[model samples]
Target chain A: MSNEVVLKFHKVQKKFGDFTALKDVSFEVKKGEFFALLGPNGAGKTTLINCLCGLTDRTSGEIAVLGVDPEKDPVHTKLSLGIVEQEVNFDPFFTPMEILRLRRGLFGLPADDAYLEWILEKLSLTDKKDVRARQLSGGMKRRLMIAKALAHDPPILILDEPTAGVDVDLRNSLYDFLRELRTQKQKTIVLTTHYLEEAELLADRVAIQNLGETIICDTTKNLLGKKNRTLVIETCEDEEVRVEIDNNSLDLESIVANYPHVKNLRIHEPKLEEVFLEFTKNPKS
Target chain B: MNFKRYSTLAWKECYRFLKVWTQTLISPVIIAVMYFAVFGGALGSRITEINGIPYALFIVPGLVLLQSTTNAFMNPSSSLIIMKYSGTLSDLLLPPLSALEKTLGYMTGGIVRGLLVSTLIFAVAAVFTGKIVPHDWGVFLLMLFLANGIFTLLGTILGIWAKTFDHISGFSTFVITPMGFLGAIFYSLEMLPPLAQKLSLFNPFFYLADGLRYGFLGIAEVDVKYSLIASGVIFLLLFAANFWAFRTGWRLKL
Candidate 1:
């Protein structure tokens, strides 16, 4: 939303013994941007997140959160960042409220009961606030993780595979909440999800990583614009029959106009999943 | 150091054990009572005095130290190992906490559990033996504090290094328990043969038990000064090890 950069990476590399998790990775996230990072499993998306939050030290390269290098000043850099990890990992004994309160305290933030209550309500966790985390359903635990991350009102939020196991209704609700946070609160967000549709719906800018290297970074509009379209034609003879063809072919329009059996015809735009496969299948593309 | 973050972590550690008082606090007290009843009561009449201290009183400090060290070691070790395996350790790592702050926070839990168990055993021993007063109050407190520090550090290290629950329990069962028992807790070094007495000097638990015995009953098989020095050196070394583990994020970081 703004020209100010919230995060920047310069040729960052991470190695685990002989295996390299991230190699020469460089990217920048602007302030108030809804950025989506797409990667296959073991593509080093979590590794990048870990580097930004100082959970692990990068083997080589430079990273800046806000204006501070995370490796040099991790605590200070972390003050402005919130993270919702891929796994649902809460202290089993603690309730949702207690977990949020504890997280806020860890950030040295003063108690804001009203804000906490509001977060619980927004996440649909008010009814389950008193229940222990271990007793909560998977969806509820995911919501609780989001609540905990947002408790301290961080300027930037990074969510990793947030909706991996979530149902459609809950995932839709999370999308609405995240959209609200981006548009209304103007919080910078970076999300990594296996669901390409989620990224398609919310992301302003998208980056796809493969084999520990970022293969593509561009505006969502530009990336989607490059996708191929599909033409679907429905016909009724003795029974209904469907014919599919590439929308870009010259014969597509002629076939619809000339075919007497054609009852309905539609052109479908390329989905994010198709584009994702295209980009990941051939990283150079 | 951010006091708020440190205190929050420390409080969490304390709260974890307190929340499971039956397992963390009560079980250790029960075990200490059994030790006192079996070893101190049954074996006391056979041996009247150990180095001028009553046999019951002599074994009291050793039992206290033994329980203190074991619980102290187990508390942080299990907490960390569970967090690691369960993937909850990221909860602490993601926060804006320095490595030192994290270490101190976890150490507080180990220290509290260790001291709590030791105090309970001391109270129970006082009732049984009718000896409530320590020979030297200052030395007793110092020795107790140092012993807790040593084991808590060890626990913190193992907690960071361990990848599985069995690894943590294995260390406790195979290393800590054997060292505590063989460290002259029940029998004096004089009771061992010459070679065994020399080997006993190498056991750190012996120095811990002897140091505590000196504090409680004013008698020690090893010199109190030497024991204190050994405990202090071990404490510093363990502290360094824990600090290194935290700072480097060994096994903790992805």
Candidate 2:
């Protein structure tokens, strides 16, 4: 609320033995921003999340969450953070409600009957609260993960693959909930997901990473707006569509001269995936 | 966070185990009683007694120590490992809980489980045999702590390093079980050859078993008082080991 950054990593580097998990990765999540870190598997997206959350130590550089360093004050700093890990960690022996209560108790929070009831209601898990975690469907288990993360009402939520492998309808529902979180609840959301469309739909900003480095980062509009700059057109003509090689490429006369049906030419626009792939094609560079 | 809340967390973990009494609570008890019935009834008749007490009585503390240590270690280590496996660890790690809070929560859970198994076995022993009195409170508590602490440390390491289900079970079978038997759980170190007797000193579990037996029977093959110092040293060492395991993140981060 105070125009302060909720989380920041300045040139953060994390290495394990000879392998670098994250290198020169730096970014800032402003207060109340719904930011997304988009990357393929093992692209150091989760590593960045762990380092910020203080689950893993950064090899070098600095990190701050809510003005407190995760290393120096892991306890205080984590107070306002919530994490939804990619894998579900529900105990087979525990019911979803008990798991929630146990998680809340770990943070030393008092038992709030009303609040607990509200959360159960919000997640539509009231009926199955008494059911063992193992019995819950996969989707239900994932929801329990979110419920656990939000148990303490942390101001920031770190969602790792929040909707991976989920059905489209459920994914859309999650999106609606997350959008509400950003707008109405004012929770700062940092999402790392493989689905680019989800990022395009919900993220206020998006950062693409490859080989432990951020290849490109900008507002979602700016990144996707690149698609508008270029257009891809399809025509029935099977001619090897080599238009021409000239500096004045957009000159209408010159463009049409090489291919008489250039008037029917389709301009190909770059998609977010194309731009992303292009950036990471030569990651070292 | 208040200790009361931490206590609640620990109780929650305890309740988790208790809820499924068949696996966590009942299985260990059945295993111990089987060991006692088979090892003690069949073989104990021939041995009669070890040192001064009845043979069954002599091994009771060792079995108690074994169940206690295993539970103490498994409850937290397994919980964490399973969390890491299922991705639940982030729930606590991402919360306001500090490393200390986490350590306390997990260990308390383990300790509760240990005590439950210990008490259950103790009750069974009381009903089955009338020899259940401690020689020294200090040594008994010390043995209780070290047996729990050492395995807790070992479990922490195993939890961190395990990548699959097989890895954890492998540690229990190859490392922990062998160590338990070697710790003189069912026999006296005096019966071993001089070389083996010398080697037995290396197993910390031996001293815990001996110390705990000494507490109950008013005498043990090893010096009851000395076990206190030994157990304390073991506790300190394992504490540091687990602290390092947690600090380094070991195989926890992927």
TM-score of each: 0.93, 0.82
lDDT of 2 by residue, A34-57 (tens): 899987788898888888877788
Poorest 10 consecutive residues by lDDT, candidate 2 chain A? A226-235
Error of 2 at B212 (Å): 2.0
Top model by DockQ, which number? 1
Q: What fraction of the native interface does candidate 2 get right in terms of contacts?
A: 0.78
The lDDT of model 2 is 0.76
Per-residue CA lDDT of candidate 1, range A88-149, in tens? 89888789998998999888888898999999999999999998889999899999989988
Look at candidate 1 and give me any clashing residue pairs: none
Fnat of candidates, each listed: 0.74, 0.78
Candidate 1 all-Cα RMSD:
2.6
